[model samples]
Target: MFWDHRLTQICKENENLSKYSTYEIGGLARFVAKPRRTEDIVLLLDQAQSSGMQTVMFGMGSNLLLPDHPDPETIYISMRDHIEVMPRGDLLYVSAGTPLSMLSLFGDLSGFTDFHFTFLLPGTLGGGVYMNAKYFDNVMCDYLDTVYYIDLDAPGRGIQSIHVDDCQFAYKQSIFQHQPWFITGADLKLKTTGAAFDFERINDYLNQPLVKESIDNSSLASFYRFYRSYLSSLEQGNKPVPEAMMNVVLDRTGKNHFDYPSCGSVFKNDYTIGTPVGKLVESVGLKGTARGNAMISPVHGNVIQNRGGAKAVDVIELIKIVQEALHKSFNFVPEPELVIVK
Candidate 1:
């Protein structure tokens, strides 16, 4: 039993975590905490440490896969509602819970134009920072001025702020990956634009209809589509073919409903494979292949989708099967993009 009576509105027992993630697939968390203030989070951490309890922090839950039956010993920290933002001239200090979509809207409304590219992404500022989320030739690290994070190894536990350069960001990774620090907030440096950035192209992409009757139902949006098209174009004499191909794929795959409960791209591209894995999978006619409700999307081989009521194990098993087949056929193992909660 937790004795911290001060945490009246911040705690929950056996909280269902499925509703929090994009995949909507996870077991209950033994304990869930939603502290209003940063100090409260520190105090909660202190108490959990004293009690020998392990802690995990989650934002909007976009790119995670939790176990079907999660370990009851774990504590989940939901920072969804603790969001707070303060503007400082060309910069904005933002708390971890602030969603990227909301931040992008704030930027647009406030005349800060650089963040417009992030308007369509489903992620929190913290997770964006962690993954260095990028699109339209810009990344989260490009606008970051500083980061404030909890120091798990401090002799006297507390939060510390570090400059952007110190974060050491690179392709979907950061220094925080090796350290035990938890991001609490960040400072974003923005610039004002005289003209409003046009989102007509993005809106057009989003408005496309899903190909419901297609044999390959796996669909992709944003980066996956961009990357796949880039590779396909390179294969075709490096001409401007990808631009046309993207439109074709987008038209065939329903735009708005593709990412309903997906773990995003189930695998990362392996450059050593020499050939794009999607083409390889397509060549083998594995597109639209299904394993107990988990299907290799026909729209894009890199994507795997949950048809209905698909279990985490089912997704994992399908991933394994795909990996094995791809490796045996092509002699290269694919890396998974989704982070599995074991």
Candidate 2:
């Protein structure tokens, strides 16, 4: 209980886990800490190490499944509020907690286009870098110059960094996954470092009531509305939205991404098979399948949705069903892209 008083300022007890995950399907969690600083993370990790307490960290809860019955003794740490952005000469120093979508917005307003691919993408930058989050040919590792992180297995060492090339980034994979490291921040290469950039504009946008509310809301529909309206406002103000960004909106909306509560994709595509997982699921006639309150999305075969009050168990059951059916039909079981936290 040595750290209890300090943690009281940032931690919540018996919080609803559904509000933290995109799937909106978890039961109550005993302890959830929203750490806004790197020092806070270190302290929490240190305490856990000394006391033999279990701990887990997540960002934005965009691609995760929290347990229906969480371990009461475990402490869940959320890195969503640790946002920080600083422009250093030609490079931008972005904290891991910064939203990946914020980079897209910053690029648009600061006269850069390379980050347009990330527009409306969910999750924080740390999670993006960890999984090498991608949009078409563009990936988080593409523009990264250097990444900084803490080794959770050895928190006594403090922060360390690695160059982008040394990160071993691949399709939906990164060295972060192979090591027990906590991403703190990174420096990104800029297309044009000489231009005068007003980064405070991004801060202003983030501070708006609607933007703040949307950032906290786990509802996919609300998330879509905020970004869509924000982009329209930019257009009305004589700032033309990029065609690439518009195309992203069209693609995601056309696929009904915001129509339901679900993780965007359930399985990673095995490119060697020469068939997408969604099409495979559809071929197996499991696209609209349901188990309890969870249903395989009728619109997107790779997505499992929460109809209303789905439980983590329901989603797990459906995953099993998909794996068995796919293995029987295709001779290979597909791997899941979504992270199911125990």
- Give the number of the best model, judged by lDDT: 2
Q: What lDDT score goes with residue 121 in model 1?
A: 61
TM-scores of all predicted structures: 0.77, 0.95
lDDT of 2 at 119: 83
Please identify model 1 stretches exceeding 4 Å from their true place: 154-156, 191-259, 271-280
* Regions of candidate 2 where Cα sits further than 4 Å from its true position: 2-4, 191-197
Q: Which ten residues in a row have the lowest lDDT in candidate 1?
A: 210-219
TM-score of candidate 2 against the unseen true structure:
0.95
Which model scores highest in TM-score?
A: 2
Q: Any residue pairs clashing in model 2, and if so which?
A: none
In order, the Cα lDDT scores of the candidates are: 0.68, 0.85
lDDT of 2 by residue, 259-286 (tens): 8888889899999999999999999999
247-311: candidate 1 lDDT, tens digit per residue? 53454345333454676556766656676666777776777888877777777776667777777
